[model samples]
Target chain A: MIKVKKEFILKYGVPSLAVIIVAIQLCLVHFQDLSRWKGGGFGMYTEIHYFYNQIHVSGMSVDSLIKDDPSMRSTLGYLMLMPNDKNIKKAAELVLKTTHKDSVYLQIWKPIVNSENGLYKKVLANEIHLKKSEL
Target chain B: MNYWSAIEIKLKDQIALASQLLLFMLGSYVFILAEEHKLWKILVLFFGLIAWLFFRNKTKHPIIWIVFFVLLTIDLFYSYFWVANHHFMLVFMVLSVILFSYHKQSDILLKNIQLLLVIVLLASVMQKITSKQFMSGDFYYHAINLGGLFKFFFTIFPESLEIAKSNSESLTTLKELNPNLTEHIVLKDVFPNLSFVSRVFAWLTVIFEFLVAVAILWKPKKIGTHIIFIILLFGILFTRLETGFVSLLAISGLYLCKNIKLKLLYVLIILGCITLIITKFGYH
Candidate 1:
């Protein structure tokens, strides 16, 4: 019985854990707009939605904002890479603290293709409007 | 000892050696990446390499594996949002090796790695199949035309470089003007049948990934299975230049592979990936 249990754990344990992780990542991708390129779903480059997705902060480009405040680069990058609400709100709050703005508007823009004409366009994937009071 | 027992011991030793070499190479490559330049990361990499070089045989110590695994876990948590998918795979691979070192179970480690390869490939195929952009070939179309991931193709299709540059400029303009604007910029194709080519490549990716997964699961020891995996690895290396991911896949392949010649080839591929990574010739 011990040998059988050992064999089963050796054979099935890690792979089963991997499967569960993949399932959760799939759900996150489908529901939370997490990029297929991330979160270890092993789905890199399956879609155009990647880290290249743009994050706009109060109508300012993330790059421009970084130029203005270099310290926020990492936080902004985190937000841009995965624009889910938690990251979005965190980034918005950071911008609020750094820039001392009354309210912060954060929007994530992702590239999409019009299949009929093969034209590429940027579409809003997610957005958040945060007031200092909310935080 | 009996002959069979002797052979088993020899094989187990080989597995240990292969795992040590592969992990050392992976650590070196990861440390060399620009994003991994933090002081603590450098110190961990330095200590790991020093221990590996001078006390190569001592790496079988479970404590060493545990230390590396713990540091890697910390790094992953610190950069969770920005960490690549392969980084996660690396962590698990290290964990498996740690288990092997602790329990002295080569079979379990090999089985775990084989299962990992199968699952990752199958998951990739599932994602590609489910993605509307991938199915419509739009993803590959943009990838080839934009020229970062598939930039190696520009050497063969020189005209594609010009198209990529033009497309980049247009996209930049559109972004600079107004991201929320509904204007769609029509992209130029490098060739008359670019769309068809992209579609064919996209479908081929799905088919090859699916075949490789099935092959690994069905007959991992077969030479034919190894050949298909080699083909898939080289195919992705040229097109995507994902040296880190490719090297990880090859290491896992090496762990499951029994044939001597294929093992050598996997070693060579891993070395080539390291060279590519160090030179920044391809994506890390």
Candidate 2:
């Protein structure tokens, strides 16, 4: 049994040690995060989601489709509970038509409200004007 | 309509990303240079190279696998799960299982792979179990999504309802993505066949992982089997695992391989590596 064990170690043990060393080398290539390596993480889609969700909160009806679809109950959790914001109501109406019409992201009409358009960028950036009473 | 806004590139960060890529490239290349200068001086280098190549065989494309793994480990240790990382983790867990079956080794590569998967799974489970408070409050709270049957329990509990109902928004793919996505939408996705797909994969994964122990034990009597298994591992690396291709290149250097065979595999792998660099660094 001793001899057999020795033979096993001699044959496979050496090779195994080598693989581990290489793995360590490969593991060192990451710049701290797995997603960072793949061009993920900091994409504009995140901003878009944030932008639309805010619009939905400001009295936009685009989220109504989500509530209608029970499957979306979990995903649209925050959108369903909060009543739409008042000041952004007109902007929300324009945003909702486009969001609900084609993509369902609640910001389809965003093209009409270009980044050059003052309110569009503000909504996209998540900055809302505070009313005196609310303040 | 302007979904294209999803890509927010920071041109200034290129300096940092480029520096990192260069560091790993040069670091990994030193071993190859040494191997060229002397035949058997780098025994450890030899073995590491072979393991990397065998794992990256299928894609016939070379990649910066070592970089991928290193980055992945950093993310795990640093606690950044983001949705993409979640996908990458799932990919890694699957690849580890496949490689665990190839070649006989005394080192704990196979065992370590298994251990890593277990650690990740346990971490995911714990994250969910402890977030019962958050789950009760946030409707889109993943304390339920990929969390599986736990959603049912949370749904009926009045305490959970009041808290969970506090928020009324659907869960987005990018929301709270770092640790695990499966925990939240498990209940809402309610697709009939999707659960079946997930279940099949889960069971198969476990079985394949345990099979590594057996594969190692049987390797001595199955020399030919070892070659085939090693190649299969390479396929899993290149195809299923992103950084695995570079690893295959590193490990392949460890063993004395046939020139012709190495050349063939190298061609396929080179294309992949080039693509990765171009996509990642804008190199032609």
Candidate 3:
């Protein structure tokens, strides 16, 4: 071997290095655990919830709210009372982070604007949390 | 002309190169492809619902949203709260329902979809960036409401369901099984009401997303970023908890992973993986 070293290894001698590199990735993925690799910090599951929950916590259900209809679901009150699940909290948190005070404004309008009845001006109607002053 | 042209070309190349470097370093498109079918369903139902809304006036036209919305709600609860899988089945269901319903109003459906998708993606990014979080703070509450991943685990691996139609021996196994096992617990359940975990998770998600965006916008140097990208894009792939793998591929194709060649390849690979994901996980 010393008398006739292979030209293949001489020209493409990175086999050992390649093996080391691949082994490193495999070992790291398996053991080193760098970059939080698969951990949940900004993981896939977290983002999935972000979008899925968007429909529920938004001012009204898409079917009813997009067209400004109030009959199908509550604008704010009942939905607010609806169990705030982990998904809702995530959607709300996204809304809060993205909109800041705008979230509060829109969140308030959820009930006010949702009433099918002319309850926006009414003192006591289906949705009770609204005050004229707030409006 | 010679020197200036060369310099201009080099500058353009460098800007493209810099963008590539930025996107490459970022973990672009985390959950974008992991729960593809489910994401597709979410995308489909999202658009179908819009289409359904466009024809909501038809009254005669029917949308069995009860089933779809139930799935959507379930997925939302799981992804945000519990662990979600098989979201792609929902995707197919939505697509199949709306496949041939193309009509005059379909253009309106398309326009609304285009506009809303932009808003959703931007809102998603904005939530990630401004708050120094990956997603949003509301995530924890959503997770709790859905009972987090544990609920899904129970749904899939129920003690009662495991027994055969009439296996008396199954009853003994049920008694031996401890429903109170914390090993099956998700992080949300572990830290039940802790708001900070969501906040922390949100911030981390944003940072990772920004990194991914950087990778998406990257320009290919010699070998290009695909090799690096596969390694990097997986910031979302390995977790595989929320969205289907295809959603991640689609998002990466549309935005974050800008190198077209790599993006296309990523989409194809994830699409191929769809069936495997579906049968193994069951649709959320």
- The candidate that wins on lDDT is 1
C-alpha TM-score for every candidate: 0.87, 0.27, 0.30
For candidate 2, lDDT tens digit of each residue in B1-284? Answer: 44324212311232222223333443433322333324333444455467566766655323334433443444334323222323333334323323333433423333333333333333323222333222222211222222322344555565654444432233344232321212322223322343344334334433443343344344422444334434544543432333333433322221212233442343344445444544552111
Model 2: per-residue Cα lDDT over A34-101, one tens digit each = 11122212111111222223233333343464555543443333222122333233333333443453
RMSD in Å for all candidates: 4.5, 20.6, 22.4
The docking quality of candidate 3, as DockQ, is 0.02
Pick the TM-score winner. Answer: 1
- Return the lDDT, model 3, position B198: 58
Candidate 1, residues A1-135, lDDT tens digits: the string is 998898778667778877887898899888877778888888888888565577776656666668856568877777666778888888888889977778988888888875446688888878999998887
| Model 2 ranges with Cα > 4 A deviation | A1-135, B1-169, B172-187, B220-241, B249-274, B281-284
- Lowest-sum lDDT 10-residue window in model 3 chain B: B179-188
TM-score of chain B of 3: 0.33
Better of 1 and 2 by DockQ: 1
Where model 1 places Cα greater than 4 Å from the true spot, the runs are: A58-61, A68-71, A131-135, B1-14, B33-60
The local distance difference test score of each candidate is: 0.78, 0.33, 0.35
Q: Considering only N, C-alpha and C atoms within 3 Å, which residue pairs clash in candidate 1? A: none
True contacts kept of 2: 0.01
In order, the B-chain TM-scores come to 0.85, 0.30, 0.33
Give lDDT tens digits, candidate 3, residues B115-212: 22222233345434532112445543333323443344435544522322122242223223332221121122223333555566556656655444
